[model samples]
Target chain A: MTKKQIQEKIAFTVLTMTMFMVVIPTLLIIGYIIYKGIGTISWEFITAMPRKGMREGGILPAIVGTIYLVMGTIILALPLGVGSAIYLTEYAKQGKVTRLIRLAIMNLAGVPSVVYGLFGLGLFVYFLNIGTSILAGALTLACLILPVVITASEEALKSVPQSYREASLALGATKLQTIQKVVLPFAMPGILTGAILGIGRAAGETAPILLTVAAFFLPRLPKSIFDQAMALPYHLYIISTQVPNMPQGIQYGTALTLLGLVSIFFMLATVIRIKFKMANRA
Target chain B: MSKISVKDLNLFYGDFQALKNITLNIEEKKVTALIGPSGCGKSTFLRSLNRMNDLIDGVKIKGDLKLEEQDIYQKDVDVVALRRRVGMVFQKPNPFPKSIYENVAYGPRRYGIKTRKQLDEIVEKSLKKAALWEEVKDRLSKSALGLSGGQQQRLCIARALAMEPEVLLMDEPTSALDPIATAKIEELIVELKKEYTIVIVTHSMQQAARISDETAFFLMGEVVEVDTTQKIFTKPRDKRTEDYVTGRFG
Candidate 1:
């Protein structure tokens, strides 16, 4: 073969190798977790409360707490993020103020998740006097994911073809009507994708919950939004690092549970996104 | 009788002048075709008629433009109401990603026609008017995107028709279609003119000659001539119009 053809073949091999590099590591991490933690996953482990400093028994409270936090975050963030995105994409003029707002949102996305935990502790937990509770934790997590949702939702909204908006307007539909009927329907799948990303982040994050609401040893379920609760990430953190001579199996099992919970959320979001996508195409 | 009138109207996009001193009369129940090369503002003029240009940023309009003796550019003209009275079809077929029935029913539904029976009747009537009912009546519930390009364009026309507008603006409505589809749309436009005031922009001079009652030649953001389609196509007026019609230059 000519030198040029040999060079091309070498480039293709290198590129393929790098692509596998990404996939292999991801599979290894998941496979390792499942292998180590699968033995601990049982009916009692999932349904029963932990015993003896979380060294034995199930992580029921952590599981429930993470669910509440995720639901609350979604409730608070989805509408706000989607609304801000709509305003940014459809109504905001290309001006200095709008540009500034956009810049701020981008920067907000880059701010570390720990900063969001601190902000939540300052605003929702202390200043509001709501104390460390599910409300505060959810609010913190929502803030952490707001930038993701807004940016993703804005992209989704913008990806809708401009012709749809023009057609709706020319047919005498008001601006709001056009957005509601034509724009939003087409953008729903994209918006749900953003929500899915936010869910995974919120469920996996320990820092935000650490400052806002995570209880070190809460063994019971939260009675209301005002109650502090144990979450999987924080539970795993404490079990892995804080407890004396913690069982390695329980530590891996907790990590596995968190991973599983986040995966379930991803699956739910994918189902919703597929439904919207089907509706749009049909 | 004039259905819409424009006198010394100018439109600007930021620093660029897109339409300048455009004066013309669109007669009631007649086809008025604006023919010009690309970027000569033929499409801009059509958009200005119904204030669809308002959607663009930094667009400025000056001078008088009216519909049925009412100043459509007045501050309180209610653009939504004006648009309902003057619907539009685009150069490309832009049927919403929805069912054929929903695409036609969308406009009337937005206008507060809520009853299922009422929507069904309007959808059927509009589709029939656009000459798409025979082909698509059985598949009204199917996605509009499933239709051919020609059918999609006709669906857009039906969508506009559902609004029950007195005036219709078509911007090269057949530009994206095959010759057969173009012929179909041309025939529909000719038939539609008997009832509605039709203002169309076309690159095809033959299309203008074939279907237009009044033909206006636009050049460099100005109208070079406006006259009976027969007079403009044959007798000639300005040297520029003659040259353009005779294929000497664009």
Candidate 2:
């Protein structure tokens, strides 16, 4: 073989090996959890309330609580994040102020989730007098995912062709009207993708929920936004570490369930993104 | 009577001047063409007629511009209303990623034409006026992006026509089209002048001679000459206009 061909083959093999190093561990972890947890999963385990300190029965309350928190987080974050993105992309002039705002969003994304938990505890839980409830936890998760949503939404808005805006404006449409009729529709798929990704991240997050809303062993479903609830991630963490004599089967089962929940969110986002793409193409 | 008039107009992009002191009057229901080399301010002049230049940041305009004796540059001038009366077609075809019917209906819809019957009428009339109705009549519901480049350009014209503007601005509208499409657009321009005042910017001198009744030649951010298209093309005038028309230099 030629020297160049041999070098190209070596480079390709090295890249393949590097990719497998990342992929193998993820597959192994998921496979192990599914294998260990499959035995514990049953109709009763999913539907029945927890019994004997979460060691004997189901995680229905935790499942319900996670759903509530996700919905609340999406409600609080989607509008704020998308609005901020629109302002930055369309309305804000390119100057020092815009640059500063962009920098602040980037920094917010970098801050640790644990820091967000403390901020939520102090702000939403205590100062606001909302206490430890679904509202506080969802607010914290919303803050944690705000940067993701804003960045993704801004990217989506920026992807729209400048010509579309010009065409709308030239037709005598007002700036707001142009955005509503032309810009937003073109950017919808991207905006929804960002929101779905944010929800997925919020669903799997434990740190922000821990200090803000999660209860130690709440077996009852949350009755309202003001009530305390049990989330999948926090419940998994508690059973795996905090609870003594916790069965390996139960720990694996909780971890698998949390992973499955997050996977479901990811799959839903993918489906929605595909639907939008198909519509756009048509 | 003049449909639009400009006097001693100057435009600046920060420190760089894009248009120098210019004065001209555009006759009503006539085809007036602006011919120039690239960056000679012909397109800029066309955009200024409809105040499309205001979209750019750091753009500054000085002096008087009037549309039908109304001072368009005044603070109280309703830009949206002004734009509604002076519609513009871009150099390249830019049909919205929507059905052909929706693309043509977009302008009327913005003005609160909500009923489907009214929109259908406007869309049909506009498309027919643009010479694209027959080609797309059966597929009004199809995506406009699926059409060929020439069809798309005509669709854009139909979209602008739906606004029912008094003046139409074309900025090198045929530069991106093939000869056949270019001929079709030139024909459309000639036919359109009976109803609406038309100001078109063209890089092709032959196109200006063929389609416009009055022609203005721009050079280095200034209008060198304005006259009947025949006189500009045939007779001796400014040395620059003569050289530019003869293809001596840009």
Candidate 3:
């Protein structure tokens, strides 16, 4: 074979190997969790409350807590994020101040989740005196995912063609009317996808909820926003590391359940995005 | 009678001047064509008629521009009302990603014509005026994006007409269409001018000659000449206008 052909073959093999290297680890982790936890998973394990210090019973409380946290995060974050995104994209003038604000938002997305937990603890727990409750956790998680929602929503709003805005405005529609009648409708799908992605992220996040709302041993569902709750990610962390004599199957089962919950969110985002794209095409 | 008048109008995009001292009167119920080379401020001049230029930041305008007796640049002038009076169609077709019916009805609905009967009549009349009703009448509920390029351009025209504006500003409205579509739009322009005053910016000298009663030739951010289309195309005039009309240079 020619040297060039040989070199091409080698390059292709290396690239293919690198691509699989990324996928293989992810598949192995998921496979390992399922293999270890499949025997433990049952109808009772999902429906019943904890028994014997969460060593013997189901994870219903954790599941409920996660659902509540995710819903609250979405309720609090979606409107605020989408609103800020609309202002930045449609209303804010391009200037030094706007540029700085954009830069700050971009940087806020990169701030570690643990730092967000500390901030939430200080602000919501001590300053506001909401304490380590679901309210505090949701607020913390909302802040953690706000940057994601804002950034994604900003991208979605900006993706709308400039010509659409011009057409609406040229038709004698007021600025607000143009946005309401034309811009927002086209941008709705993108904004929803961004919000769903933020929800997915909020569901999987443990650090922000760890200090703000997650209970170490509480096995009951939260009655109100002010009550402490057990969440999937923190529950998994506690069972795997903090608890003594934790069963191998139970640990992997908790991991698998957390993965399943997060996967559901991601799947929802994909479905919504695809559904809107098809609607747009048709 | 003049439907609109401009006097010593100057427009600046930040520091760069785009339209310089453009003074002209657009006659009532006539097709007036603005023909010029690229970057000759024809499109900018067209956009200024409806205050569409106000959407761009750092844009500065100095001079008196009037739609009839109303100075449209006055502090209290309602831009929305001004736009309703002077509608615009873009160079490329920009129908909303909606059903054909919805696209046509969007303007009237926005102006508080919410009753279904009124909207239906307006949409039908506007589509018929734009020469697209017979073709699209069957699929009024179909997505406008499914239409071909020419159909989309006509849809845009129908959308603008739904507002019932006194003047329609078209900026190279058929630039993105093929020969057949361009011919169709030119025919629509001739027909539309019987009721609504029409101002169009076109690169095609033949198009201006075919549809326009009056023509203004702009060059380098200024109106080089304004006259009857026949005179501009046939008779002796400024050397630059002659050169541009005869394809000497852009």
Best by TM-score: 1
TM-score of 1: 0.99
What C-alpha lDDT do the candidate models reach, one value each? 0.95, 0.92, 0.91
Candidate 1 vs candidate 3: which has greater lDDT? 1
TM-score sort, best first:
1, 2, 3
Residue B72 error, candidate 2, Å = 1.2
Interface RMSD (Å) of candidate 1: 0.4
> Over the stretch A3-95, how does candidate 3's per-residue lDDT look in tens digits?
999999999999999999999999999999999998888888888898887888898999889989998998999899989999998999978
Candidate 3: regions farther than 4 A off: A1-7
- Better by lDDT, candidate 3 or 2: 2
DockQ of 2: 0.69
Model number 3 iRMSD: 1.2
lDDT of 2: 0.92
| Residue-wise C-alpha lDDT for candidate 2, range A1-282, written one tens digit per residue | 999999999999999999999999999999999999989988887777899989889999998899899989999999999999999999999899999999999999999999999999999999999999999999999999999999999999999998999998999899999888888888888998888889888998899999999998888888999999999999999998898888889888888888888778778778877776765655
On TM-score, the stronger of 1 and 2 is 1
lDDT (10s digit) by residue, model 1, range A1-282: 999999999999999999999999999999999999999888898889999888888999999999999999999999999999999999998789888998999999999999999999999999998899999999999999999999999999999999999999999999999999999999999999999999999999999999999999988999999999999999999998899998888888888999999999999999989999999999
Chain A TM-score (model 2):
0.96
- Give DockQ for candidates 1 onward, in order: 0.93, 0.69, 0.73
The residue pairs that clash in candidate 3, if any, are none
Can you give the lDDT of residue A44 in candidate 2? 84
Name the DockQ score for candidate 3: 0.73
Q: Which stretches of candidate 2 lie over 4 Å from their true place?
A: none
